[model samples]
Every structure is written in C-alpha cells, then in structure tokens.
Target chain A: MTAVVPPAPPARLCPSLAAVYRAQLSRARGARIPLLFVATFQSIGIMVLMRGVVDGGDGDEARAVVAGSAVLVVAFVALNLLAQYFGQLRATGGLDHYATLPVPAAAVALGTAAAYASFTVPGVVVTAVCGALLYQLPMGGLWVLLAVVPLAGAALAGLGAALGLLAPRPELATLCGQLGMSAALLLGVLPEARLPEPVRWLRDLLPSTYGVDALATALEPGPDWGSVAADLAVCAGVGVAALALATWAYRRAALR
Target chain B: MASSIARPWPGLAAPEHTPDGTASAPAAFTVRGLTKTYPARRLKRSRTAAEPAAPASDRITLDVARGEIFGLLGPNGAGKTTLVKQLTGLLRPDSGAITLLGHDLVRHPRRAARLLAYLGQESTALDELTVALAAETTARLRGLDAGAARRERDAVIEELGLGPIASRPLKRLSGGERRLACVAAALTGSRPVLVLDEPTAGMDPVARRAVWAAVDRRRALDGTTVVLVTHNVIEAETVLDRVAVLDAGRVIACDTPDGLKALVGTEVRLDLVWRGEPPLAVREIAALRHLAAVAGRRWTLRLPPDRARAVVAAVTQGPAFAALDDFTLATPSLEDVYLALGGRGEGLVRS
Candidate 1:
C-alpha cells in the first residue's frame, strides 16, 4: 500500500512578529472607537476640573494640571483596558489558543502590549491638545509629546498585562487594574509640591508621573532641555523594563 | 496490518500510489512512558476536604504509523486532552520521551512546532476576529506567506462549507459554525501532522460527516498523519486505521476496529424487529442466554459463530417469526467492542 505524498506548501519559518502584531491589533477593532472616546473625554473632564482649582495660579501649577491630564489618557486605555482584556483572555482559555501556535511567548505578550499602547495614542494626542488650551500653556514644545505617549503607554500597558497574567481570578485582575489607574490619577494628576515627603517616593515610582514631569518641563518658558531629556530617558527605560517583565510573566502564566 | 486499502471510505478520492516500496514507511510519532501530574486543589466549599494530586496521564506509550488516521478514544476526564497537549508541546511531560518524525519533542520542541498543526479543545484566541481572518492569521502564524495563507484559508473554508459566514465574527457564529471555523484554521498550512481534540463535539451529523471526510481526504491526498481525539467512537471507527481506548488515564485496548471487535469473540448478532412479544420457543433457544433490548421494536440475540446455524433454524421455525417485520445477522461493530471493554453505553449507540 503506497502512501501518496501530496505537494507540500512552501516552507516558511517561525511566527512573524509583524503578523502577530497585526492580529493583535485587529482584536481591538470593535472597541476602538468607544474606548478612545472614553479616554479622551475622561481625561478632558479631569483637566477641566483641575483648571478651575489652578485658575490664576503660577505657571508651575498650570503645567502640573495640564501634563497630569494629558498623561491620564494613557492611563485610562493602556493601563485599565489592557488589564481587563488580558484577564478575560486568561480566564476564558485564550492563552491555550496562542500556546498551540508556533509563535513565541514573548511575541504574544509584546504584540498585545504594543496593540494596547497604540490604542492610547489618539486619546493622548487629544488630551494633550485640550489640556494645553485649557491651562493656557504654550504649545511651542508640544512636539515632545511625540516621544511621551508610547513610552508612557508601554510602561503602563506592560504593567497591566503582567497584573492580569499573575492574578488568580479575573475579578482580582480588574481590581488591580482599577487600583493601578487610581494610583496614576492620584500621583500623575497632582502637583509634586502638594505630596508629602514619604508619598513623593510613590510618585517617583509611578511610570506615568515621569511622563507628566517630562511634558510639564517641556511646557516651561526657556525650558530645561537636559531635564526634559532625562525624564524622557527614564520613561523609555521603564517602558523597556516593564515590557520585559510582562513577557516573563506571560511565560509563567502560560506554562503554569 | 500493512496492506493496501481494498476500498477507501465513501466520498474519499483515491490516493496516487508510488510502488517503489510501502512496507517501511516511517512512524509519525513515537511516545514512550509519558506522564503528567496536576497539583491537588483544596475544596472550595469544604476546606477540610483535600484531594490528592493525581496523574492525569500515567506512563502512556504508543506509536502512530505514518499516513494513518489514529483515534484516541475516551470519555470526559480520561486524560485524552492532557496526552495530546504533551504530544503537541503545549505542556511539558513529567517524564519519558516523545519523538516526532526524528526530533525529541521535549528537547527539540521547535521541530514539533514546524510539523504539527493543533486544534485546541476551545476556540478562544480568534473569537473576535472574522472567521476568514482567523483562518488566514493562523496559517500565517504557522509560517505561510501572505498569498499562500490566503489561498489556504479560502480553500479550507470552501472545503468545509464555511463560505456563508466567512466574513462574520467568530463570536457571532453558531457553536457548530465556530467549530468548523476552528477546524478550518487547524487544517491550514499543509502541515504533515494534525492533532484535533473533539473536532466534532457540538456538530450535527452533516457537519460531523464533513469533518470526517476532510480528515480522510488529507490522509489520502498527502499521506499526512492525523491524531484524532474524540468520544464519537462509531463515526471515528469509519476512518481510524487504529485506535487506543483510554479509560481512567490508561490505555485499556489498542487495535484496529475489527481486531478490537474480534477480541470479544466470533459472535454474530441477530437483530429482529418484531410487532409482538417474542415466542416462547424463540426465547428457549440456548443462544438467547444474553438477549439485549435495542429499542421498543427491536431485540438482539448474540450467538457464537458455531451456534449460528442452530439458532437460525430455531428462530425461523418459531411462531413469532410471522410477526417479525425484519431481521439481520451481522458481526459485532465498534460500539459493541466499546461496550465489552467498559465504555458507558449512554451516548450514541449503533445496532
């Protein structure tokens, strides 16, 4: 009995990172519009409320309110939404679907993080524009935001993904995401001068706070370029570190 | 056991033959002493109740010959899924070795990834993506290029009759449609080996037949190896070259369907559809020692091969023979083999 051998498909190699990224991006197509709207309007409302309190205040206070509101956009979608997505994916056996594929675990984790981070861009841009107008801050150095959104989004999104993977239940993961977003709001949206000495350490630890500081420094008249670059560098470093940690966490959850 | 097919399953296209040699074909998978243990979990409602850690698969050893459709038959919690997961490299085995093609599955898992296309028990990854895109993306992930992936996606979708809902989101599709989409995605990329877990779980008879036909077509056309894990024993029997019946984490029987059926004995089953109660003379036949009720209208009498002539003579002479609408005598089927080997006769049964 002869075993007939059919013509084989063209041999291809490992999973393409770009393909995985595209697939992951497509997953959010349905929620993209509503999510972006929520992130934008929510950040704008926070800015509007902060604007009233900082009315007729010094430029430093104005910079804090505007920068904080802008970074809040990243917090809303990247941190909050991403956590819930991963949490649901885990609880629903979605990881098994990816695990059976030829794709590397890191690609799955990073692709998801990149997709969630990309979703934050429109919100971040809109919030930055509205916050600057509300605070009457100069938009001269607004170009710095081009670097700020992704870096802050990556850092927050990675953390959110990690939390979702590590949590034992989906509900707990959602709670962790909400708590993380709340921390971002309290630390990122408030001026550092008003924070206590001990609580200031937490502000330093919150990745989005550096994003706010960077944007605020850039808005200053005759801004300190060195400080802005330093803050941006820290944001970039944290983004890389958080993403690596998230990839590690993904491997842990999937293999477990 | 190594012989040409006298006749392939219905609807299967004949395979092209190469006559150089057929006796020395390779084995697709060689798994030896594989085992997996899940940690014990404390009972949620009663903390005092603690269950011991159990081995899901205990020292499983099997060989799947190349170009064969092999079935892994078992009921729920029978360790079929765990064993398949280990074979496909999704879960690490606690011990022993799995050699796929030539590479060690535990040591060189990347090789298995290239050769095996797996359909998981659940379709959760691409639930939000359109069915067509899901199929195409999975093909892409399996290393098919853009054009090839699209072609494969289209061909598989058409073959499985998924054209009507190809553009619909998987979440919007019916359970059977979603299952067909998952099967289509799994069959893409022209991999040498396919591992499907419960591919026909929620499918109707038509869909189930379509899936079986597709699997048979693959084996006939490409000499591709298939490892089918399912509880649909009767339908699975039609295509299975060989099967391993697993129960409580162990393989209790392994053989071709006919060979397994022969294990019970050379018994011809006499089925009669009667309009009234059986005659006293018919029940007095010695072969009726183990008479079984099939349905309201039918009754079965299992007779040993040697006693067939006497039983036939006795039944034809009985007064109840006039009330019988129809009667058939046949060898035992795979369902009988399943029942004689401890399978629960609760689901689909064939007479």
Candidate 2:
C-alpha cells in the first residue's frame, strides 16, 4: 500500500452566493428556454387580443392593457416556473443534496430564485416593447421598465419560492403557482376601474399590481413620476419582505 | 427463534479502544442511545393503526475506528437509512449523542459537513448538471476556489473514467452511468468521512467493481473512514472491515465479518430446488423438516459440514433423489449470520 496522503479539507464555511448563482444559472438555461418563449408569446398574444376592443392608443385603457401584459411575462417565468422548480426539487429528494452541503439555506434559495428571475428578463423586455409599438404608446417613458422588471420579478419569484418550499406536495405547489399567476393576470392586467370594488381591494394586496401601475403611469404623456416612484417604492419594500419570507421557508423545508 | 445472538459476539471493541499496543485512541465516529420516532398521523377511517407508530430508529449505539470501512446490512426498514441520515445531520435524532471527530453532532448538526460528506440513496438534484459540472459544483460547494474546484473536478473525471460522458447531463446517462457520476460528484471533496447509502445500487458487475476499487483506494491512500448502507452481502463480505446486522431499528450484532461468520461455526449451507412436491416419505427426512423456504419452489437449510454429504446423497441419489430437482452446497456466508440471528425476512416494517 502507498503512504497515506489525505486530501486537504476545505477552510471556507460555505460556497459563495455568486458561485451558487452562476452554477444554478447554467443548470437552468437549457431546460427553461421553451418556457421562456411561452411566457413571451403568451403576453404578446394577450396584448394582440386586447387591441381590437381598445381603440385609442393614447387612452388609459390602452396603457393598462399594454403595461399589464408586459408584467405578465414576469409572472409566468418567475412565479410559475420557479415554483415548479423548487417543488420538484423537494419531491425528488433533491433537497438532500443541498442539505448535505456546507452552503447556507439562504444561498440555495436566493441563488435559485435569482436564476429563475433572470430568465424572465428577455421575455419581459420583448413584451414591453411589442406592447408599446402595438399600442402606439410613447416609447420615451418605457424606460421605467428597468425598475419595473426587477422589482416585479423579485416580488413574484420570492412568492413562488415560498409557495414551493412551504407546500406539502409538489402537486400542491404547482397548483399554488398557477393560482398566483392567474391572480396576477386578472387583477394586474385588467383596468382597476373595471374591477368590482371588493376585487380592487385584492388588486391592492398583490405585489405585481404595483408593477403594473408603475408601468401604466409611465406610459402616459407628462406622467406623474411621483406616483411611479411610490408604486416602485412599495414594490421594493414588498420584494425585501417576500425574499425574507422565502429564506425562512427554505430553512423550514431544509430542516424538515 | 433459531438465533445465535444469545451466544454473544466473539470480539467487538468500542471506538475508544485501540487494536495496537496503545490503550486509548480517539474514535472517528461514535453514536450512543440514538433514537428517532415518527409521529402517528391521521389515517383514513378504514385504516386505523392497531398500535402507536414504532420509532424509525430505536436506541442504538456504535463506534467507528479511524479509517475503518463499516457496513450496515439488513432487510427493508432496518433503520439503516434513518441512522445514516442522523449521522449526516439530515435527520435529527429524538435524543442521543453523535460525536464525529470530537464535535457534538446533535447540538451542532450544521457542522456535520465539516468532517463528513453524504451521498443519499436517491436524488435527482444533479440530473440537470453534466458529469463534470456535478463534480465541479460539489467541489465549489465544499469551499474550493474556482481554480481548485476545476482541478479537483478534472482529477475525479479522470479517476472515474468519466471522460467519455463528461459533458453529458446525468439524466441522459444510463442508470449505472448516472449512479457512477453521482458517486464521483458526492465524493469529490477532501472530507475525512463519507456516508454512502447503496453506492453501487444500479451498477453492473464491472461498474460495481470499479466503484469499490475507487473506494478501497481512498481508504488505503487517504485513510478515509466510510459508513456504508447496503443490502449486498457479498460486497460487504469482501470490502467491509466490520459489519453491523440490524433488524427492526436495532443492531442485533456487530463484529468483524470473520468473527460474525465464525458464530455459524462449521455449518454448511444447502440450497435445494424442488422437482415437484416431495413424497411424504421424503418430506419426513430430519433435515427437510426444518427447511427455510427461500422462494417459490426452492428452500435452503444449514447443517453440520460433515452431515452435508449424507444430506446431499439422500436428496440426489437415494429414493428421494427422484423427487429432487437440483441442489447447491456451499460454505456459510455473512447473510447466514443475519438469518441465524432470527431475522424473519422483511418483518421489521409495520406496513
């Protein structure tokens, strides 16, 4: 037998968040492309359908239609798909892989959420631009999406992650993800004025509604930048709270 | 119950004991009074439990010497997995002390990865990752820098002969290939201890041999301590330095393989296949009266080695030979030790 030469043990406590993020990003890219396309096309298709009923491109109705569709892309990939991802990981005993690692529970959850949220970017941008052109809305104010995409994506992705981790079964997680996206669609995409009084109260509770509202106000002529900032501020606050909730959910599930 | 457990193990030492002249040596791992119970859940009205749920892991204790390759062998629901899970810090024991390398694991479960790496029995987390990436990622997760991670990944790929499918995702590989990749991935880092559950579960004979070769080399060169959970008794006999036979969440016996088999003591195993239902006259043979039914149309028995020839002759050439289909005569194995310990074939789990 050869003399023993043990491999040196690791000195660091856990893997860096960036390292985990990069790895998760690469792992998800191939599987999520088709779904990313579905999100983009679904938003564009919805916008096209609404174009027939709403005539004036400069009206509030058109702005609501365009902005709501754009944010819907974020809901699909970040909210729906991220839920499915984590739920499936839980069901397949995949959590064992992470639980055994020295990595913190936060790194695993946030890193995965960030990767799934990143997939929504291209889809969100395309829908926003296509909606702008289809509605003949002013393109100058469309830049608010820089703020809208991340805030909305963060908010939805966090909720998706929490739902997946908290759900007792993978099927229940999928159902929750679907239900959340449907709420985003009906409550976020519809004009607030058109909703029932009680339903509008629910619209206020959803984080994505603030994103839709911010984008809608920005698409108008001489828009009130104050309202957009307030909406976005609420979004940023909700994002922090939601992400914190997600981190808690990850710890609970990992321990279980 | 035809059990030899009453005879006691010939030689079983605690982890604190040294085999050499030294009297006191630190153990690599130690477990004392480990127990975990599952809570009874609400069931359908038609299926109420007749009794409270049994503890998944009953009070158990063992010690693993430094650099030892220990094996846990048993039938289904033997608590092997639950025990391993607690050791890896994946499952929390209800109460016990799990000491690994001087750290109190029960109180500081997160520190488990400090000295141990665990490979679970089933997982799909790495299915999306390529073979090289799986190893590279695990290395990175263990706190290796990107450059060192790559070097470690490359070394493992070469060691495991995974160059052909280095870029292939685990899901794209065959069952054996996927299992091999998972092993390579889980064992990539320099952790001192490894907890492998059924490491060669889906492997072919050649792949199985390759896996053991790698594990054996690690033990020989790195002096790594390994705790393996497996049902493959043949592999356990050849590779494990020590074996623990568990039944119903408890260790019935623990000793060196040779020491445990010695308890069988000169007994020869006889496996017989039936030509048809034996004549009543043939069935009355004293040896056939105590047959342990193995499976459909086959039975096995153990007797004194000297009597094996007479029993063989009676079943193969005498008037009873007309009723016998086939027979195999062999020496006792570690599995015989398990059965001789009163194991009644998958009777542990309260299904």
Q: What is the C-alpha RMSD of each candidate to the true structure, in Å?
A: 6.2, 5.8
- In model 2, pairs of residues that clash are none
Query: What are the lDDT scores of the predictions, listed in order?
Result: 0.78, 0.80
Q: Model 2, range B1-351, lDDT digits (tens) per residue?
A: 111112211122333443342212345677888999877776777565746678888888887766778899888788889999899888889998887766678987877876688888765878888898888988888778889889989988888788999998888899889998988887777677889998988788877877888887776666667899988888888888888888888898888888899988889888877777654476445446656556776778788976778778777766677877888998878788888888756432111
Best by TM-score: 2
Chain A vs. true chain A, TM-score per model, equals 0.91, 0.93
Docking class of 2: acceptable
lDDT of 1 by residue, B96-127 (tens): 88877655788855456677888887787788
Candidate 2, A100-186: lDDT as tens digits:
887767777777777777888888889988998998988888889999988988899899999998999999999999999999988
Angstrom error of the Cα, residue B293, model 1: value is 9.1
Candidate 2 residues lying further than 4 Å off, grouped into runs, are A1-15, B1-25, B44-50, B279-294, B346-351
Q: What CAPRI-style quality would you assign to candidate 1?
A: acceptable
Best by lDDT: 2
TM-score of each: 0.82, 0.91
